[model samples]
Target: MVNNTDLTICLFPKALSIPSGFVTLGICIGNVFVIVSVYSIRSLRKPCYIILASMALVDVLTGIFGFVAGLLFALHGRFFYFGDTVGWLLHKVMVSTIALSLLHHLLLAGDRYFAIMYPYMYIIKVHNRSVMLTLIATWTIVILGLIVILSPYYSKDVQNVLEYTFMILVSTQMYAFHLRIYCKAKKTAGQVSSSTCQAVQNNRSDFKAARITSIILGAFSICILPSLIHSIVIETQGECGRCRLPFYVCSMLAYANSMLNPIVYGISNKTFSDSYKKIFQKIFQKIIRLC
Candidate 1:
């Protein structure tokens, strides 16, 4: 329902166009590597990695859509060409992708939580099939939720309330799950001395995975909180002329999360780091042969 005139009135500075383009490109390329690594590396085909790959896939879409939207914004200072409906849908899809990315973080945290807190059951239940089913369900729910929110039945206020509620619930659950995981890992470490060597090794592996996931979760929280707060303020107070710039900055920060995630995974997981190296080596060799 946003018109071009209103959009142009609050257009982001043209100087931001290049930097935003680069960031969006990085987001797409980085997440593509994540998805490829997860699929190609047999070792990374576990539940946690599957969820991570799914998240990366969503991020790729976000970056692509965001690039188009940003390009339009920067070029014309508004989505003048797309008309209201298409432009509105593009923005909504981008928002939905971000929501999907956050849900995947929760899914990743849950995977780690169960792996650490209930290893036996986790081994039995959290396989490829179950993970796939869970992802399908998540996609369906989010898509349906987006449809309901976008329907004319709900006012803008209602949509904002629903979004705010969803964000809080997901953030709370993810934090709670990680907190329980940390407590469980600490307690198990104290008891490790009496355990068998194999058990200890397994415990260490689980703890390591949990730690890496925690880092990703922390990064997501930091990146998203600014945008979430800015959004709430804008919704409640109505738009301020000065607030527009800050909102754009906050949105860019949120977009930065997609770029940061792949780096975190590579740095935190030796397996992913090695896979990246191997992929680069292959590409290098191919270029050399071509030359």
Candidate 2:
């Protein structure tokens, strides 16, 4: 077993570190784009879109805390800049963000399902004030959970177990939501015939939503499974010195999920795509005028 003192938590070889830093930088930028696009476009000011904006905010924080901070730690090779307390706080923030990100994915899936399955009820139940309250409640729960994780009540082993258990539960809930959405969408499509142009357009929109849901799930599973599996293995077996590299790689992959959502969901949607194009075009024209 590598002693906690001896084990370098964030250090990576030059080859790996450089690439990881680049990936993290890209994630930060992509998440920022999501935040900007959601707020800048007037058409995207609905409940579901507000949820997306909130998700992007979580992702942006994740990129900064999980990836960017880790990169800085790797570069410094120690906690010389921030000291031990900052490092500990960063670790807590990373875990908290990861939990929030997982919950947010499920939240998004549930929001979509509700909007599709109970459109009228959703309108009444999930209004702007309700959405705001829900978000606040979620963050409050997460913060409380973080307090427990940081408290001395749980030993390190217990903490690991709790974290893993939380993740497994979240994963299960997300999958259940995905399956429910699929079945509901299928049933809805079966009822709504594509006989009229409007009906056909509605069907196409549903299909697109399904495709986007699949992409989100696919990206999440790919990025998260590696880390989840690795964590489980580490928990089962005692610490292996050689496991550090793979753990770091898997962690990077998990954080990469933050980047993939904007590309898959935001750019794929027509409204956001058009907004993004206009935003970029204006920025370039301004640059040209400045020059």
Candidate 3:
């Protein structure tokens, strides 16, 4: 295990500035695209898009506060030095944003599952009011998670255990449920084609939605799961020196999740993708006409 002093000296600001800055920029841009695209396009407003928009909003904050703050810290070689209170606040904000994002992802999965598995009930029962309630619940859970993480009552190991266990269980169960829904939808689609072309089209659309949801979930896991495991191991071992580099890399990867989400979730949907293309084409057309 390298000492903190050695870690700081080796990862000097001059050596770290360029790469971290580039990464922060990329993440911010991707998150911004999702935010802007969703807001500008009216057709994209639906329960599913509401969940995705919530996720993108958090991702934007993550890019701005989490990655951008980290970039500044790296550039100045502050290396986790923001004064005690400020550092604590930033820590809470960063962790809470991440937790909120995970909650949004789960809500998105639930949205897709219900929409597919129970379309009629979903249409009647799930609406803007329900979306608002879901958002409130998401924030409430994030707040509680932050409180537990910040509280001194629980040992760090205990906190890590709780967080990891909750995340793993929720994520695994959500994915499994989504997989079941997708399979059932697929089977139904295969059996119902003879009934009507409309039924087949509806089934196809459901399959597409499920496929996109699964892709987003897969991307999220790829980006965040490593950091989660690393955090658990570090907290359990109570030694961060050897884990510092890996943890930092994992953190960057986790931040990258925010960047990938908009592209994966937003652009994958036909409505959002079409809207994005139209907006860009209009801009280019105006430029050509001016020329």
Candidate 4:
């Protein structure tokens, strides 16, 4: 007779295990490069960069948490390993960091919208004192949300409510940011240079901002849906459906959101792409010279 744990372990190895393992491991590795790229470059230090840095920090933690637990599950088959009180605390920080990243990225969309469309107004409004105040308020709001999400009895049922609410609000907010940008483009007499005109007329700059914001928003919802459903069902005595397919798909998509930041910058920002390439070449050449 097969034991429950042994049976659980056996089930995954027989199924679509290869792809599941690949995305998890690859994302974890890629996020390290993304983290290094953001912090090493000085020009990336705009306030929106504050949001990006936060995203990178959180994603790195998420990758760590996910891979550690995920790889263990893959190898052991059916084991769900979490430590005691200490593990619990670490988990909270990890969850908070991830949640905070999501919230801050939403703020980043708003930040970029203001910076791009109303550059002068933004500087005046967010001058030294105001910038600090806004950041402080944002920090407080995110911390409070994280606390509520990760507090006691973290079974999947509570997770569903949280996920649903988070998604609905995020989706709504993205549209709001989208609407705001469209309104600005209509109202303003933007620059007419070949480059800056391309940026403003085609709305390239704002669109680039929106691209990151939209992807972060859209991918987050798409990636986490299965996890949300899985958590709730598994926790509450709901459908114990063996839909490894959905979980695996969702997990991979979620992992991509972490590394996708760098890929977006590479495509959208010429300066960032050039700067990063130069920095990496320098580092590589120095290593070769040393050798």
List per-candidate RMSD values in Å. 2.6, 3.6, 4.6, 5.9
Candidate 1, residue 145: Cα displacement in angstroms equals 2.2
TM-score for candidate 2, residues paired by index: 0.86
How does residue 193 of candidate 2 score in lDDT?
56
Model 2 residue 251 CA deviation in Å: 1.3
How many residue pairs clash in all the candidates, one count each?
0, 0, 0, 2
lDDT of 4 at 143: 74
TM-score, per-candidate, Cα-based: 0.91, 0.86, 0.81, 0.68
- lDDT of prediction 3: 0.70
Q: Specify the highest-TM-score model's number.
A: 1
- Model 2, span 160-193: residue lDDT tens: 7778888888888878877887887676675565
lDDT of 1 at 43: 90
* Predicted structure 3: clash tally: 0
Each candidate: what lDDT? 0.82, 0.73, 0.70, 0.58
Off by over 4 Å in 3: 1-16, 71-76, 144-155, 189-200, 241-243, 278-291
Ten-residue stretch with the least lDDT total in model 2 = 1-10
- The model with the greater TM-score, 2 or 4, is 2
lDDT by residue (tens digit), candidate 3, 1-291: 211221122232445556666766766766666667777878666677767777877877887786646654755556444433455456667868877887787887888788778877887999977897889888887888787766656464575567677788878877877887877876786565666677466656666777787888888889888988887676577554433668667766887777777677556777766765776688899999999
By lDDT, the best candidate is 1
lDDT of candidate 4 over 17-127, digit per residue (tens):
465456556556545555566567775555665566556666767667666655555655532333233334444565565566656666777876776677767767754
Tens digits of per-residue lDDT, candidate 1, 118-224, equal 88999888899999999999999889877875676656667667778989999999999999998887787766657778967787888888898999988988889
